[model samples]
Target: MSTITVDLNSKVVPAAQKIWIVHPGRNRSHIDTFESAGVVFLEFPALALRPEIIADDSLLRQRIRYSTAVKANKGFVRDDGTPIHIADYPTAADTDVSVHLRTVKHLTTRMMAGDLVIVPGRGAGGAVLFGEVAGSFFPQKSIRAAGLPFADTPVREVNWLTKRSKLELPAHLVKFFEKPPAIAEVGRDRWSEGFFDFAYDAYSTDARSWVSLDAPQYDGSDILSLVPPAELLALAVSLYRAMEQRADLTGLDYDQIIARFYDHDALAEAQMRFQSPGRYNLKDKDAKLAKWINGFVALALAGALSACSNGDHIEFTNKQAPNDPANAELTAMINMAGQSAGGAVLTKAETQAQHAQSKLGMSAPATVR
Candidate 1:
């Protein structure tokens, strides 16, 4: 791993022209070490969460409260003007469904990928989400064929094989409450994987290629020029549900998964759930971990705002495994911002936040499992 170091000194590169240097990885020779201006270089890693696939169609139907089939129904005019009817939503029959979920996300004063935003509840239907939402939540589905033996190819090949796809129009319209042939694309570029990029096409003349990308569905090499409205809604709902579900998964299993990805001091406590270790109950462990993460987010936000200002430059370099208990990416971003423009815009919002926090008991909201 290469370390990233930023020289804030005015001599090396004027504070106004500070350069963030990163020693490129062996395989990443093309990546630059510095940027010249506005929003120069960015890298948002793709996240492929293993969602608890709700394949049980019956359960899904029950979750959505689908009783009447509504093959054909009639309605009467209301007192004022509108028409009212007790009819089943056409999407109730769809094998896939996406429900809009509203919740609060916890973000630090610094910018980081995969920051755990708090959603309100837990369990099935605690926070209803859609099918596209589920797919987008854990969008990174590994292509098994590419990873199999005999292919000592390259990471680029593996990367290329990891393209993302979406559902067709008719099915999407029924599910996401949108018209047929809608544009649906969101987040970052799946090809290179940066930030989420979503575009809409409910009002496009050409419904075929609403999103501007090379389309394989059509012939050889026709670039996307239009995006369908339904497709866009499906993409949005899928992303929303994926995020909501991810926030709700806080358990021994989740902790174990986190430990597998990055080691933490809490690993021993998490591992005890499997063996006859001590009287370490998984529930308490889960609560403590959740509380820990919550506090870390609070502290990081507070610290980052205290350090940075606008127009300041910060560099994030990997060092010794990922450590910054609060989440390395987050901490690095906070540190970077702190070294620059006297904290971010949130510093100004602190007063309003304090008022809200005081009204709400000042205790950080607990994440639902």
Candidate 2:
């Protein structure tokens, strides 16, 4: 049986004082009021803006005008009073641009850093959405409605915590839902602690929880320190070579080899890097490129191990294992080194040396070394 290790230090600790719960929509009468007055509330699904457009005042004004027209069902008009139909502005979608812009402006200008906005869960026992305002308000194209008309929206850069997992309120914190406020601040008291504890517990118990992986677990920190790419590549290559040469390791299962090598940390770290949105600049561009390179190294090593497998057993024969060629995904990851991202690759000599060192029970040298 494989033993699972939990890193207590890596668990996410929620801050209650920064938390605020928001009701997604107003009463039906209120929505009707806005609609009757030719005002679009644009509260459904929530509006997320692009960064580039937010910075440009002139561009933002134009987008707002178009967006407002779309929301109001009034055709857009050029500054020179020429009517621009919705078909003419294929970039604008059904988003309420005015509300999105105003909301983004309010969030960026009025909200403090580290503030968290919580969107209530739909239906009974459903999960709520938690969005942490990571940065100031900015205008950018919407990923949710990309390549469609009216795609531009105002968005505050947010680190959404509950994007993947749904969280239920703990039994103790259920009272807050009794009279859920349209927008209420969650204090750093017992209720807040209970809520986070419930969230953490829910996250831990989920089948898709990241905590089960052995890599440096995500603690919602902006800065993440990771192993260097070159060093990681060397380790992966060395592991591949070791698996290739070991006669005693034949017929062992993949899990057995993984346990023996005890390098899941590297594997997990790599998986996180490769999978993380920040690595692809989907979130923050400067989230640390080192992590991405480290991910590539992890992928290479994991691929090398995977390539040696024949069905349920690991084939350690030299004929079967030359490089990690069997894994197309791994090959693609290694090829990333040649791409614009510029990750490191291990030389044959260096790989051999590292393999020899591993055979002698020596740890791989640090990146700096």
lDDT (tens digit, per residue) of candidate 2 on 184-238? 5567553354444322211111111111112223234423233232344334433
Residue-by-residue lDDT tens digits, candidate 1, 1-369: 222232111101011211111111222222222111101111111111122312433343332222111111111334455543333233244523332100000001111222211111122222211111111222233221211222111111100101112221123222322222111222222121111111110001110111111112222132231122112222222222223234322232322323333323322222111111111111111212322323222332233223333433333221321222323343344444333213332353343334323332222221111
Off by over 4 Å in 1: 1-297, 300-304, 308-326, 344-346, 365-369
TM-score of 2: 0.32
RMSD (Cα, Å) for all candidates, in order, is 27.6, 18.1
Superposed by TM-score, candidate 2 places the C-alpha of residue 274 at a distance from the truth, in angstroms, of 34
Instruction: Return the TM-score for each candidate structure.
Output: 0.17, 0.32
Which candidate's TM-score is highest? 2
* Residue-level lDDT for 17 in candidate 1: 15
